[model samples]
Target: MIRTEFPEALYLLILIPFFFIIHYIYIKKKKARLNNLVDKELIKTIAPEISYGKLWTKFTLLNLAYAFIVIAISNPQIGTAIEKSERNGTDLMVCLDISNSMLAEDIKPNRISRAKQSLNNLINQLNNDRIGIIIFAGSAYVQLPITNDYSAAKTFIDVIDPSMISNQGTAIGEALEIANESFGEKNKNKSKSIILISDGEDNEEEAVSIAKK
Candidate 1:
């Protein structure tokens, strides 16, 4: 669609007719003055370049140039057509337990390894959705901010281990709080969800209450 950046400049067009009127009046007064000073025939012979046709032509050209300048000042712009697509996915936060117990070999390769694999598979299935990761043991840290970059998410997930956190205990409450804070106020209107992947070893009973909040 075409638009004008300075539509107020178009108001200058109102002076176009006034330009011609003033030019016409000046020409008539010059002619009357010349007629009183000298004969019309002599005046014509003395100044052959001074013809009503030439003056009118110059006036028309000047008016056209003025109109174009005014239009140029308005700064016309054409915008590209944009196609809107609806986002049909919610914001998801995966809170993974990365305590020492996750290193236990109870689940195939290990709990932490299995959790990473599962999270990777889940990321691969996402479309138009933003996902973040919160890893916790004794404390919580944001492994990945909410984003659609599944590749970065997987990269972060692969590096998860027990040593990342200095403290050592399952603090699911802090993990949930961190996940809640990760969502931010920007996506408050969008649907949000948190998936906690743990061996149900939450030492903090406040995890459920924090989730409810």
Candidate 2:
């Protein structure tokens, strides 16, 4: 996983040999100047501090320092960013009717309770498919936007009550329209569907013909 951010900086390594060539020419010129000033045997006696071997050591250290700098400039990094893969499955929009009549005790504890239980079970059975919720009484509104997060969906569904909306009638057409819109335009070419749960008391706020589209 270790990688260099600037691999191009590694080209600086090529300058090391040229540094050595320049150091050699400079050392030769110093020696030639000393030969003109004094005999080769007496040069070391006159210049006690001037050691050609020490100059080579200094040049070698400088080159090492330059090499380390080049590597530092390359900026090596560890680990990599994880890429998220898209989940492939159908999209389902649940249009649940929460009108006052849905609270009738005809179906076990109440009709709305039973419908909510069914929604939770459906979510349990879902695999990678995305789901959304639209609660409709006299009007429709998105309770949950389309998402694959089943836990959040369950949290939203468990708290749904018939008393949430003041308007009390089954707006199935409005529910269907909102459900269609919630599917989104990008999913037009994909598999999309809606599951309507109601007590069969619809006032038809809008034409359901849009559902066919």
TM-scores, all candidates, are 0.58, 0.57
Each model's lDDT comes to 0.89, 0.89
lDDT of 1 by residue, 1-213 (tens): 898999999999999888888998999998899889999899779988778888889889988999999999999999986899897788999999888888899888998999899999999899899999999888888989999998998899888888898888878899999999898998568989999998857767888898997
RMSD of each: 10.3, 10.2
For each candidate, how many residue pairs have backbone atoms clashing (under 3 Å)? 0, 0
Candidate 1: clashing pairs of residues: none
Superposing every Cα of model 2 onto the true structure, what RMSD results?
10.2
Q: Report the Cα lDDT for candidate 2.
A: 0.89
lDDT of 2 by residue, 1-213 (tens): 988999999999998999899889989998998889899778767778888888899889989999999999999889986999876788999999999988899898999999999999999999899999999898889999999999999999999998788897878998899999888778577789899998876655454676676
